[model samples]
Target: MARTHTPRSHLSVLHTSASRFASSPAFYVPQTLSESGDVASWKPISYIQFLHDVELFARHWAHVLKLDGIPRRSVIGMWLSGMTYVDVLHIYGLSRAGYIPQLFSIRLPNPDVVYELLSRANACALLVDPSFEGLLKSCPIPTHRAATTVYDIDSHDMPLPSLPTLRERDTVFIFHTSGSTSGIPKLVPCSSSWLDSAITKSHQIAMPSGRTKRNQDVTVWMGSMCHIAQTFMLLGSLQHGACTVQPSRQAFSSNELSLMIRDCGVNRLNQFATFLAQHLRNSRQNPRLLALLQTLDDALYSGLALPREEEEWAHGNGIRLRNLFGSTECGAMLLSTRGPEMFLQPLDGMSYAFVPVASQSEAGTSQGGHSAPLLELVILAESPDCPDNSLRAADGHFHTGDLFQEIRTGCYLSKGRDDDWIKSENSLRCDTKAIEDNIRATCCDLVAECVVVGNGRPSPALFIETNSDLPQPKLKREVLRRTRQFHSRRYLHERIASADMIVIVEKGSLPRTATKGNVRRRVTEEAFRTVLDKIYGTEWTGTT
Candidate 1:
């Protein structure tokens, strides 16, 4: 029998993208933003050219590498810029040769973190970008620790080599989750089929038809190549026949972004909610800038939810705002545009076989501050490829620590993470989501984001990221007042440590998911350890 199209396989993506959209451009960086991170006229790279490059890379993998015919699939650790053509080809070519290509973040300049990742991955060979030279220098271990080695493909003296055949199930991408849990990385093994499924679904759901190079969802891939967002942007652009707006090495500023969108005829954005909010606030000062955003059809974000007013702002401006919900573990429980029911429905011949929801207790207080219990997500089979899918429980389902509620039968809404639950200083259980949600509802006008801290402390304290540029006293008062109100009424049993426990911080101060843009509670709590201690210590009870 002939090979039938399987679940989101990239084995065919290469052929289809190159053949079906042969004339279309695969990668585009405007002349204003060039390789040097300066204004320089450069031609776009077409799908054909991209494929030829992939061929070269594949050949390099087959013959040039010392570990060409290794027993196991070699893991090639990649350190490259976001959404670069080389990054795509490196991954595509490596996948073809049965090598797992894992990307490291360019923004993480810290040598220790980079080394820790490399050591953990045990990348047999590294394909590093020239810019990451400092990373090479900082390798405390013997550069070739154990059997590990390096291959600077850019400067390698080797010529073109033959390419090897790839098995559809040959690739399993290794992803390191954001240090959301105690600053330790969670290594996730997501197979190519799983990735292909995500990319295809994302392309099918997110990419609108009739998109041209000038009026396409020309996303400036802000997330690092390591992120799932990068996978969507890179491959989704290819499938959609759209152009990826590659800004300079640095992310586009509000002014620069506005100019780029206007001049480039851009149509989409994937950014942090806080970042977009700040830009919107900036736009108020320059009405012309705000007017420019009206051209976009959609803006996708992760991290903080956009305040209702901002959501209204997007709606009034004829833009669709989406807060994508999911984790590296669950492959996106919900997308912004689609209903939760649609997600659970089989997409492209792949289904995890969903199970019924059940009530699960955690260390934290219940749904209504120790009243109702949170419903646990018991996913039966998230993916066949992820053999290590621990989300699956002994009950033959992936019992997620995430709480959800079926609003009306099929439709569902995510409450928060049950795993983030912790005991408060006052002997009450608390979770970051409940605190953040309460703050957003009660004090939306006051803070950009209200992160609940003080895990294992006397009481939960608020790390307030104020929305305004104005003086702090009034905003502080507003937050304190709101906290008092929530404590008195909605969450009577779970009291928020007093006003003085609230610490006002600037925007972008807290850490967030690179892809989803969701705030990481554990990371944020750790970051404000001093403030947490203050809130839990002797001064906490006496705090003004």
Candidate 2:
């Protein structure tokens, strides 16, 4: 059957870009770096070269599939790390060569979950980095399915074969949820039409005020490509004609990042909020990194929320930090470009609704001490903002588990996930994220990181991770004093009942997701089950 051609086909876009910007540098890879965090040497891959590389990979994979007798358009599961050009190239090349690429994080802790995802995706083959070839043996996949590493293909300048036509609804790429909340990742297939619409919207969406990255700006992605954010951002950069730089290492130190910024003339930084916070913390001692950050056009972050203190520090230091808001199921829909408070605005032409959540109170007291309405963001399925039909609910809208607080008529600030709400024994519910944010904002100096528990208990308990040498009692007193001051107006069920509920944990010891380092709330709660039990003295024994 003939497949309908979509205008947003990435292969077509790459062809157009290669012709339009043949000599333009598509990516800059760090070749060498000095001990003093100086870029000693680097290599730039031109757009023409990039297209040629894509074709080269496509041809190599095509020949491999021919030898293995795997049919075209078969789903191929990829487990590549290193965050190098190889990962990006493999994804693009597979799509161009008429195969669906299913991306998997190398950091997925369970081999069973990986096998299950692969099985669910009906993956006919596996492509992996050499380092991860052991995964093939670890998973009990069918022996008939072919498995190949990056080095298995021998490249030659054979003429590229005709690419297969892909239908609008055909799956081009497959992504997965963060699985931090769900405990197991869910597959999210990116359709051709959906991706096309996403790319088109990317061009229409306005960058945050005073924080836009120009087409000629140098951008660097600081996370795994397995993440849909990085992959989609790369496409957006391509559409915008921005030159991206791939760091020498998958995981680089703050000093190494500074060197990349210095040597690569990097104008935009795209990283997780946690890493950005870490850089800010490191910048306290290393003024050079801070200076380099101040010089950047914009620091784009997503994944987790940046700590309140670190966010303020960035703004005070003259760094423009923009937050990209979206998810694997829905793609990017919102961007925070206005100011340090990180209020999000929807993309141009994207229709969304902030349905007010039924809270116990008439209105919740927000961080600004104003009675703000709490709403859950919903993307109307009929709107252009809707990515795919996979996650659309029976109501015909994609209900993002994300909750936002209305700052104004159109602007909204993230208040964390809907599941982040804690229901007490009395049936009163409070936002765990809101309480934690308040405590962190007020007790920034006393608490490095914290989590609030007691989902079905009488009251919430606090867990703190701090670097201060103060005694546990004094630290609890100080934290409680500040938190109480911040939560004086908040409902009693929303506040920690007493100082005994504040448990001090070791710094950097919170359980976090492997990909973005977001603290797994449920996992963290489970880790301190005994301590929480002791604090509560008794379980509510009610359905959470």
Candidate 3:
């Protein structure tokens, strides 16, 4: 079949696809999860049915929310805590009704932050999943306690309204940052042009080199539906006539995910690094799960760096792990190709540049312990799909605040956040993310979490939360050995001098950001102030 010309806007593309593939399956919904976490059966939702549901919800919201005569592009807040296919449908439904759906993250547990974001977006109204209505008793906006489940029941026939005319620069969706590094999450508006580019670029890069076909028969999305990446992928997949499977429960177990992968015949998988690590660990004990994972055509991860040992293990076991790099501000930018180091392959239709970062240490050493200058990624404003101007700096480019190191010409490795660079008292700069990733990867089996501190102190200290049941003495010995192993190839100032510098805490004790559950390094450092004082109080002299 020859490809159809791409539509001018995101909703137009969906409208076209629904008309063309009316009977084709757009989603495979798990009917039920048995006690053992097995999927009993799958229910396919066709393109026409999905479009019909969207239309129904659009009309219903228009009536109940009194959206009649509302101005186009009015902001509407949506928080569907336990995400489902219905929530995704409502996003389109809201957009079709000439409103922008501003999504709130389920991972962000604090209602105050959500309220702040809602006020910041100037949302006209807020709609929440019925299950989470209790959370926002004091919400300032006009809160509507509703559920898409009402539309699930039988509905009277209604005439479909004409597609609203939307420009390329029109805001279609709104997402926010996790605020893992920054304090409060900021609203990121996605333009129609941005969504269109994402859909087109995703289809272009869907196929690998050796793959004979470009069809994504069944793709399982394992991340939060509120995540921008998942949202982009969902739109892209539907436009390409692919079937997607998502989790039914708020929190799905590994067994449930594995069952979905096996039963749904999933070829492509998109998951976070933490969940991937858990699956990898579980696969070690279950060969059947390992075999299922190896059968996947494409395995992708983002949000955080995958541990080195796990990446090696996946590739060794024939799982083609691909790293996806993108942000809420910018749609998908790069997809890593097969290589020794995960060198990024830039996607088409996006304009991005790298600005050189200053040398870190007195020796003029850059990040990654190499002479190559570390580069900060800048998303050029000239890109065809450039979204809103909120993040654009005075230079007319959105500085992503992400740092990368070039390993080869035109290929780079993501080093960590440029703002996360820590300077020790000896004037040597330490890459905190690098050290944390290394320690976590090296001692993955024993450590639940790791954070490096001591910004202006003698040396960086290692704080780890133990995940193992081994005795403290034995665990400390093993941890020290691994720490030494990690320090073997490092420069002098980057190493944690003695075993005394290693502080072990109880599991689940580290402070995490309310948004994405990422460890709040500054907050954690403050929480362990006494321990840090004790460690740094003594004459912790090291050769500098």
Q: Return the top candidate by lDDT.
A: 2
The superposed Cα distance between candidate 3 and the true structure at residue 81, in angstroms, equals 2.6
| C-alpha TM-scores of all predictions | 0.64, 0.73, 0.73
Per-residue alpha-carbon lDDT of model 3 for 1-544, expressed as tens digits?
9974433655676788899888888888778767766566778888898887788877766655553344556898888652567877777777776788898755555566678788888888888876677788788878776565634533334444457766667777888764322235568887777777777776665544345364446777654556576776776676677788866552356677677777776777776565566677778889988998887777887655665777888888988788887777776777787744678866776788878877543123333566766788887888755657887898888887777767666787776665665544422345678778767778899998988886545567888888899887787778778766555434344666587778888778889877778887767767777788688783212111
Cα miss at 227, model 3 (Å)? 2.3
List ranges where model 1 is wrong by over 4 Å: 1-8, 33-43, 61-64, 67-72, 107-122, 137-169, 180-183, 209-217, 249-251, 337-374, 382-387, 390-396, 421-544
RMSD of each: 12.4, 12.1, 11.9
> Quick one: ranking by TM-score, best first?
3, 2, 1
lDDT of candidate 1 over 1-544, digit per residue (tens): 9975555545456667788767666666555554445434334677777777676666556454554334337666666654555566666766665567666555334455556666776766666666666557756433321111113343243444433344445446776554323323456666655665666566654566353434345665645566555665566666766666565543356766775676654677766554566566666687787777766666766543454566666666655566665455545445544311212222343344323344343234422344433456554454442334443457655655656544443444455555656433222235556667778988777778767765444456777777776577766676667666445422222446466667888887878888778777777876776666565553221101
The sequence of per-residue lDDT tens digits that candidate 2 reaches over residues 1-544 is 9975554777877888788888888888767777755446778988998898788788877777667777788888887773777677787877777888888766553456677789988987777666655646656543222223335445555557787676777888888765322234567888877778777765543232245544476788656677666777777777656688887553356876776787777787877664566678888899888899988887887765665777888899899888878777776788885576678888877789999887633355666789787788899987754756766888889898777888876788876666776545433346678778877778788878888876555567888898688999988888877766445434445667488888888888989888778777767777887888778775323221
The whole-model lDDT of each prediction reads 0.56, 0.71, 0.70
TM-score of model 2 relative to the true fold? Answer: 0.73
Q: How many times do residue backbones clash in model 2?
A: 0
Which scores higher on lDDT, 1 or 3?
3
